[model samples]
Target chain A: MKALRYLALSIAAVLFLVPFYLVVRNGLVSEAEISAASWTFLPSSVRWENFAELFSDPAVPLVRSMVNSLVVAVLQTLGQLLLCSLAGYGLARIPYRYSGVMFYFVVATLMIPAAVTFVPTFVVVSTLGWVSDLRGLVIPGLFSGFTAFLFRQYFLNFPRELEEAARIDGLGHWGTFWRVVVPNSRGFFAALGVIAFVTSWNQFLWPLVIAQDQESWTVQVALSTFLTAQSINVHELFLAAAVSITPLVIVFVAMQRWLVRGVAETGIKE
Target chain B: MSHARAFWLFVGPFAAGLLVFVYVPIGWSVLLSFFDARNTVTPVEFVGLRNYADMLTDGPFLRSLGTFSVFAAFIVPLTFVLALVLALLVSQISFMQAFFRSVFFLPTACSYVVASLVWKLSVFNGLRSGLANTVLSWFGADPVAWTVSTSPPWYWLVLVTLRLWLQLGFYMILFIAGLQRIPPVLYEAAALDGARSWQAFRFVTLPQLRTTSVAVLLLLLIGAYQAFDEFYNVLGTDRGYPPFARPPLIYLYYTALGSGGQDFGHGSAGAVILTVLIVGVTLLQGRVVRR
Candidate 1:
């Protein structure tokens, strides 16, 4: 029985790790080595120059896309932090007559498929001439219903003592929020930030449409163009994909627990 | 300021984004289904459901839906079974539980784009050097065209395997989380009642996981509908794609945004149809699960 269990795990682990090993191994080698009809498990030589080549390649603009990805990811994460936290504060704490309706409206956004909104949003953004601009990629995605819902749930269960003590000290709503709630919720912010940053960094379809120019292309968009445009550079493509996911893997490794817990917490109560 | 007015201050930016990005677009999509929306401007021609009528009967679009159904049919069960089995296996181990969980969950951090590249370029590459072909050669079988072959099901094999590898980890974690929430004393009591392992699992574990199963099922269905990145990266190269591998989004993409200018009306109608299908499935799942 123990052997059977071990065997199953070994198979699953091998299946999971083989592609990863291949991508990493093939990424560090020459293009010729990768495209050959047959190949070695390990390269005869390592080529750090492949990455330098990708960065220096004038046609693809790898470094610029990396910077673009960082901007989109970081900016989107910050925007969501501010907006969702504030909205969540209002909906969870401040008792307004219409807060229930407002909460429902926000929650309802989660159900709508993004495809349903793609054409009109594209038209609107194009009409505003946000095509080939960062605003088109970043602004449309800043506000997430899921993140807002997360913040709302988090704040709903928060103890009132902190807010009450702040109120007793003569602070108003905004003051209490800025001074108290934000500080207390730093861990949640970090967790959500990592997740949001990864999502924004990985965005492909929307960025593919709007980041029409080479200057504004995010990493994923640029990587896709590398594959489809004229010639396919097998090694470069593998290397670029490896490059794109490296940041996410780092963030996940460093904060895997919080990320997992955050996602699990998103589940609606039974 | 009034309390209500202050509330709006907190809600303003998010509400504005939601309106511009989601609500307005959805509203416009519904309207566009009725009119000839050839461009961003107001449609000059009011076709009165001609766009909907045309797309519904369109062979390629309808066939794309059918293809999606088959793809989902393969992936949903495959992922479900594999995830459950892995979850069960991992949860039984006392050592390195966290390590196993983290390794499995690692792929979930990778984008669908990267996953597709890994699967397509390295694993399922059409050349004899491709990993799949290399393995087949050991068995004395001819190198099969994994992505291009339409005779049998090499393309489906490529799609299904990549998707399962990418997603199985995520669902496994979710299932493990669900399983861990079930108390052990219940199983002990079942054992005392002369129940075997299989019987205990059937009555105790299965019943406990109902909510998780329903949630997982709904999420899987919706995600299967949105299978674009992997599909586009793997099979979609140029203007032409094999009919067998086309999903609804890819078909609609070409129909609406192809090089020879776009027909926005047809695209919006198709998008609306897909949205309705997703919403319908979720509602049906909710009803069934509730029962």
Candidate 2:
């Protein structure tokens, strides 16, 4: 039984990692070998220049794009965490009339498809003169209904005695939230933080719509440019893709524990 | 602070964001659907249902709706069954469960654009040099234009399969969570009663996973309706060939923001219609789940 389980898991793991392997291998191989009938798992001759070529390529601003992605990811994650936690804490802790109504309104936003909002959001961003700005990319994403919902659910399960004790000590609402509540919810925060980071990092459509300037293009947009460029360099394009995704893969590995917990919690609840 | 005051304070920022970012946009879009909005910065003139009238008479919009319905009809069931089977298989494996789970979940982490691009360039490349064609050549079969061709509907199958590959892992994880919640003793008792593996799953697992199955179905339906990136990336705005594979959202996107031209009014109508369909489907699914 144990051996069977291990075999099944091993097969699953291989299947999952095969795409990553293909991507990395394609990145390393020379352009000639890529179109060949059969290419070895390990490249016969490593093309280390592919990495440098990705940055130096005049058409695509690979380095600028990476920095743009990093900035969006960091800003969106921080803002989402703060806003979501505050709203979630209120929903979980405060007993007030119409709270349920407000909560439902938040949940309703989750159902609104991005396609429905895309053009109008474009209008809003354009009107605000934020069309090619990093602020446009990060600010809208900073507050997510899904994140608020997740945090609310997590906070609902948190113990209330600490907040009560803080209150008894004459701690104000803000003081209680910062000194008492925030400290106790580290795990929940971490879990939500990883999710927020991943979502912001992998975001494509809004960023694509808003960031018209190449200087502010995210990595995904930059990679798309490579794919769609007038002169398509398959080797360089694959290498750029591999490079762009490397950070995300690393982050996923690092935060696998928190991600798993978040997924499991959300799945079970839903 | 009073409870009402505190609640208002707490909800203020988030509410404002949601109103501006979500509700206001939706309201504006709905309003725009009644207007004759053009690319110019000038004020939009109210045409009051002319866009909807145009949509009613529009052949391409109807075709897109029909194509999208067909895509969703095929994709939802295919994804659900694949996810359910994979979930059941992975759940029964006790050792290295986390490894399996992470492996399945990895695809979910990839953006649709990335996955679609990867499949387009490398996996489903039309030329003989493509991965799929190369693999088929070893089997003494001819190369297939997986994305380029639309005849025989095999191209649609490739698109659906790619979507399934990307989405199966997510639903599988959800199903696995649902499966884990079922008490082991129930399975053990069923086994003692001489229930076979398939029988045990049918009688025990299937009934227990009803709510999750409904949720998964609803999610899949919404996702299928909202599928723009995959279709947009794979099939460019122009229907390059005879049998076009453009989904509704793609059509909406093209109508609204395509390089050819922008017709915000018609596009808004399309979006509104699509949103209503999705919401209706979701609500019906929710009712079914509750029952």
Candidate 3:
């Protein structure tokens, strides 16, 4: 019975790992090898330059897309961290008349799926002349109610004595938040930061719609173009997929514990 | 500053963003649904309920709803059972637990577009070199067009497997969290009461995981309704969107953006319809869960 369980898990693990393996194998191999009728588990020779070739490809503009993705993800994450945290802290800590209503309002926004607002949001962005611009990509996604809710839940449990101590030491609300709360809540921030960054990096549909030109496309959008653009090199497509996910894979591995805890908190804490 | 003043100072940016980005769009969408705002964003003609009526009666739009329902029926239960089983399996094992957990959860980090690309091009591509076809070749079978041939609807396999691979781990993590929340004392009590392992899981474990299961199920349902990225990537081509498996979002995408028709009225109408369905289902589920 014990052996059976291990075997089952091992099989499942292999199944999960195969796509990544195939990606790497095909990514590093020649286009001819990728299109070869005979299947090889591993490439005879791994070409490290396929990624460089992908970057050099004129049609893809992957480097620009990567930069756009990094900019968008970093700005969006930082913005969400600052904005959501402040809102979350306010909603949790401050005694205000409309606080309850505001909290519900944020929660209501969470329930409204992006599909419902996708078109009108486009219209709003275009009306603001943000089409094919970073503002369109970055600004709209900067504040997420889900992240705010997470922060609100986190801050509610934060020790009040520290804030009181800061208050007594001639600190205002802003000072207390910066001096007392922000420093101590690094773990929570890091967890949410990683989540936000990964989410922004992986965002496809919005970027696909907003970033019309190749110059403004995010990595996901750039990758999608490969699907329709039949002239693109096959192995380069695999390489691009591999390269696009590398940052996220690193973040996922490095922040594994926090990511798991954060996800768990999102589910179980509610 | 006063508490209220400080609160606004802190939350003002988020409030402004939420209002501008979320609420305004929703309001605008409702308004657009009532007008014939085609080839332009500005309101052209007052169509009243014409857009809504047209969207409701549209064959493709109705088919998209049916598509989501079929997808939800399969995905929700499949993910729940698989994730629960995975959680249980992982929880029981003492050695290499973290290793297995990470391996399973790793794909959650991958984007849907990249996953769809890999699935379409590498895994299930019609070429004999493709992984699925290669495996078939080993069994002396002909290379079958996974996405191209709709007769057998083998495309569902590609879609389901890709989704399962990407999402199973995340749900599995949630299940693990849920399982961990089930106290050891409950299991011990069940054991003292002469319950078998399966019986303990059936009664104690299942009952303890009620909230988590409800949350997971609700999330899965929402995820199903909001399914766009994978479907759009895997099946959508330069030729046009595939006739089969077009979810509402995709249909709306075609109506509003992809088709170049810019039928904002009908698109917004469809969006409102979808929102109503999602919100209604969520509230209904909430009531059921609370009971």
Interface RMSD of each: 2.0, 2.7, 1.4
By summed lDDT, the worst window of 10 consecutive residues in model 2 chain B runs over: B234-243
Q: Write the per-residue lDDT of candidate 1 for residues A147-192, one digit (tens) a residue.
A: 8888988898888999999999998889988999899988888878
Model 2 ranges with Cα > 4 A deviation: A1-13, A37-42, A267-269, B41-43, B237-243
**TM-scores of all predicted structures:** 0.95, 0.93, 0.97
Best by TM-score: 3
Least lDDT summed over 10 consecutive residues: which range in candidate 1 chain B? B36-45
Reference-based lDDT, each prediction: 0.81, 0.77, 0.88
- The runs of at least 3 residues in candidate 1 whose Cα sits more than 4 Å from the true structure, single-residue gaps closed, are A230-232, A267-270, B39-41
Over the stretch B175-244, how does candidate 1's per-residue lDDT look in tens digits?
8889989999999999999999899989999899988887887778777887777788888665555666
Give all candidate RMSDs, comma-separated: 1.9, 2.5, 1.4
On TM-score, who's better, 2 or 3?
3
Best by DockQ: 3
Give the TM-score (0 to 1) of chain B in model 3: 0.97
For model 2, residues B1-291, the per-residue Cα lDDT tens digits are 887888777777988888887787678778888888877322389898889989879798889878878998999999899788778778777666666777887876776667766777777877787777877888999988887775766668667867877778878878887887899999999999999988998999999998788778777877787676666566542333233777776676667777777788887787777777777776776677678
List of chain A TM-scores, every candidate: 0.92, 0.91, 0.95
- All candidates' chain B TM-scores are 0.95, 0.92, 0.97
DockQ of each: 0.59, 0.50, 0.74
lDDT of 3: 0.88
